[model samples]
Target: MKHEDEMRRRAGAESIAGGDEAEQLDQDTLIHELRTHQLELEMQNEELQRTELELIEARDRFTDLYDFAPVGYATVSDKGLITQANIMLAEMLGVDRNRLIGQRFSHFIMPQDYDAWYLLIVKLFRLNLRQQTELALKCEDGSICYAQLHCLPVCSAQSNAIRITFADISEYRRIEAEKRQYEEQCRSLFENMLDIYYKTDMDGRIEVVSPSCLAQTGYTQAELLGRRVTEFYIDPAQRDQLLSALLRKGKVNDYELILAHKNKAPRIASATCRLLRDEAGKPVAIEGVLRNITARKQVEEQLRLSETRYRALFEQTSDYVLVMEPRTDAAPVIVDANQAAFEKHGYAADDLIGKPITFIDTNISPEAVAERMRLLQSGDPVYFETKHTCSDGSTFWADAVARYVSIGDSNMIYSVERDATRRKQAEEDQARLLRENRALMRQLMQVQEDERRTLARDLHDELGQLLTGIQTRGEYITMHAIDSEVRIMGEEIVRSTSALFDASHASLLRLRPATLDALGLSAALTELTGERQKQADIVCSMRIDGDIDALDDMRAIAIYRLVQEGLTNAFRHGKADCVNVIIRKLPAHAGRDDQLWIEITDNGKGVHAEADRTPTGMGVIGMRERVHALGGTFMLTHVPEDGVRIEAMLPLDHSEDSGR
Candidate 1:
């Protein structure tokens, strides 16, 4: 604007001087000079008008921005009286713009801030430098607002006015209060919880310590603060690495570690760490919690030790170790049994599992086991046992200890079995050994019983028949060539001989059945059981399923012997009116056909072995060893209502597979 004014004045002065220097004035010359001077003046006036309009538009734009700024903006005279104020500042003060003008700022300031405001004004006047202050202002409505005000001397000395811009912080203050309340609640919780909580900077310095950490680590907050986290770690390097990982991954959980506390003792703890990131996703700090798991760690160690000690003990155990569950169905079902449990009771783990415990143990009746199942549904526990049968039809002794335990939070029954087969077998073998044999003494003690049976059968077949033939000849002679009295005596002799032979033959067959060798086990079992069926033929049929050709002789022999013993118990001892025997190959898996199964089922009086302890029985113990000798399993089941079932499984691990 100043440049335009100067140019207009120079042009006017030059034209006036040119006119004064002219002497002759022709009509045409005079007209041209006047018109040129008029044009110059008009151009100057237009230039001045354009400059004025431009200045007005620029001032209006600035004024609008100043009044409409988000923050409170104002201008004041040197005397601290308001010269101009934005609508925001005017509204904040609960005053109209017209009313706010010319008012002294000190009138709107809170009483407590009067001295601060005075000091700020003095600083701005003296130093002519920009300054900022936080102060409270009392609005016309009697409400107080927090603000950060920055003031600077904007105009020259002559103008003597100050420009101020400020930010209102009332909303920020409210949010801070809420956050502080939340932190206090968290602090209270940390002070009482059994778990430990902590926070750290990105550099691994422990910045915040929860009160629970004191109880867990015996360290004071002051002792922990600003300290490198590695200082308290049992493995300092591990601790450093974990912190670095948290910074990278943003979060980690279930991290196991050992920490040395103030007492200098290491405590096993599981720690979780989470990173606090900035808006840019870069880690700023870490927060985490820890739980002292020393007890659980100790338990794990003890279990490992137990397994080592029990490795050899499994073979030598006097009592069977059974993992059995009670019954299922309308009755109780035996679920699972270990090697020893199955050996003592004559069953396999797979056979017994998923069934009721009653299938094997008979200590508790089927009805009782059913009631106990109800108890389990109500989260209660019960104890019971039952007898079981093997696939080859053998019985066994077993004892179990069972109780409900937790896997995490789910409930499950934990059973440990102590096999009592050896003890019972030792007693039986001792009682029966001396009466059986001499040269075949210790080793032949078992075979002697079978030999006795064979001898009886020989006597019945050979000697008894010879005597009967002789008696028949004699009777014929008496009737034809002698007297009536002699004939009667001969008939009596023949009848007595027949009775004696029958008993001896029956005993011989029981000692050892020769049919076992003549035919496969399935055939032998069917024939042997057919004889028993005449007396106890409550069951309709007995059958075999699945491929059974891969079994070795010993395994076959074991199964056959088991079946003989099992049938005796089911028919003669168990008073079971009905029984079913099943022999089959196991489920076919790819590259696996090493398993064969034998199952004997009966609905009769159950042998209730105490679930808490092993019971006695030679058939049970013998069947157990036989199955075990083949590197397989034996398990027994004593059902709640349905009676007892026994299963024996053997693995032909050496047999070649067809990859079927």
Candidate 2:
């Protein structure tokens, strides 16, 4: 349109120039031509004015488009200053449009992004082509935003500047970063989780598998992908069953299957699966987690076998077994019983099934029933001796042991009753025999004491006196002899008589120590210890506590004999170097009346191990019998690396004494 106006203007000017020669020929024609020229100029001026208005409108449109564009546009001078900044550019920088003019563009760039911006600008000018870069830009409010800058170098005759267009891409970059992080997390879970995660296509061909599949199925991701899922199953039918379930239910949980490993070993697995469908809701693939359940399956099998064995034992045992359920009223109700139980009670199985457990027990008193209830409530076993009545109206003793047991979900009492009638009778018989034997033993011990006293008296009176008289006669003969040979014969006779007297005295002491009857227990023990020390050349010490002299004859005699036997054992058998005897009166305490403690210790080579292995020796048996007969406790211990010790505790009160 401008070119057409310019052509018309030039043609008018040429026409006027050509008409100047015609004006000299005719004045009137010249005036008319001037008038036409004037009209033409007026028309030309109107056209020019209209064209100027159009140009102004177009310029306004261009300015508005540049300023309101989605992207920020700016012209930057070679010095990195902003020569022109549109409204979007000012808004992107968080500044007013007028405030951005002549401002250094580099000021808006983050310090860390300065180098990138500088290099970008340099490249844009050096290549004189469009160059782009992403950088963090600082806004007027000190906030940071990520942006992509596209720059085109503008080098013209009038000015040298770069036109740059940038967009605020902070939100896009933020979303991209979040997406990357989510992908990383998902990848981590897929690779590191223990259970097998897999995806399959509609055809049952493996589409993808996690790294864990390698460990779960002994097949790597590479090996499993693109392969048929049924190929790994021990029975392909199992896969078919799984697919059928998935198709029918749209999902399956804890579905058991057997899959074969690379080594051809069958593995038990439990799978939880769901259908993966498209937008059309058609099942495209199956997604699931498969967990190894081999251990659980093995445990289940073992439990099944164990239950079988337990059932066999429960049915076949000879001891009567009763399974009863506890009730609020009366005793427990007998729910079931073994054949032995019915046979022992002389009742048909039907007769006892619904009856209370107390019906079979002849002596189930209220207190007994209460006690059993208490034990059951506390989850403890009940063990007691009770008599059970049979159908014949006769009763027998039974040792019943009942415990609370849980079978499935029901709580019941499992009882085993053994026929204890024979055992109880045998125990009574043994007790009677033991009493009779103890009575006979006491009588025998008394008789033995009498015989020993008599023998000791004979040796002391008759044999001792006779030996004394012979020694006296021999001594007189030696002193009054008239010849030396007769004197020598008399001296030899005296020596032999003296030896006989000594032997008789020693024998009398062994039979019954005279001091025991004459001077009480302490004096007798002192005398006995003295004799052992002298004979064995051992150091013997005695500690007699309390008033031992107050003891009666029977106790004194027993104590004297016990000490005599202990010292003799220590000196003769133990070959002890020192003997210690302690007799102290024990004060009465709860559960124990006043007692006497006699402890004898010897520093000797400890008692031989073989001696312990022996069932009984005469000396030890005699000591134990004497102590037990007096209702006392006796202990003989050979201290390791030390010596032998014999201790006895005899109750002072003889009211409960079995020996008497």
Writing each residue's lDDT as its tens digit, candidate 1 over 554-651 gives: 55556766787777667655678888888777675897655787888888776554321223335666666556545567898877667678898877
TM-score of each: 0.35, 0.55
Q: Tens-digit lDDT track for model 2 on 317-384?
A: 99889889987767889999888888889999889999987798857887778778888777778788
Q: TM-score of predicted model 2?
A: 0.55
lDDT for model 2 comes to 0.83
Please report, in order, the local distance difference test score of every candidate based on alpha carbons: 0.71, 0.83
lDDT of 1 at 38: 72
State each model's C-alpha RMSD to the native: 21.3, 13.7
Worst 10 residues of 2 by lDDT: 609-618
Predicted structure with the largest TM-score when compared to the true one: 2
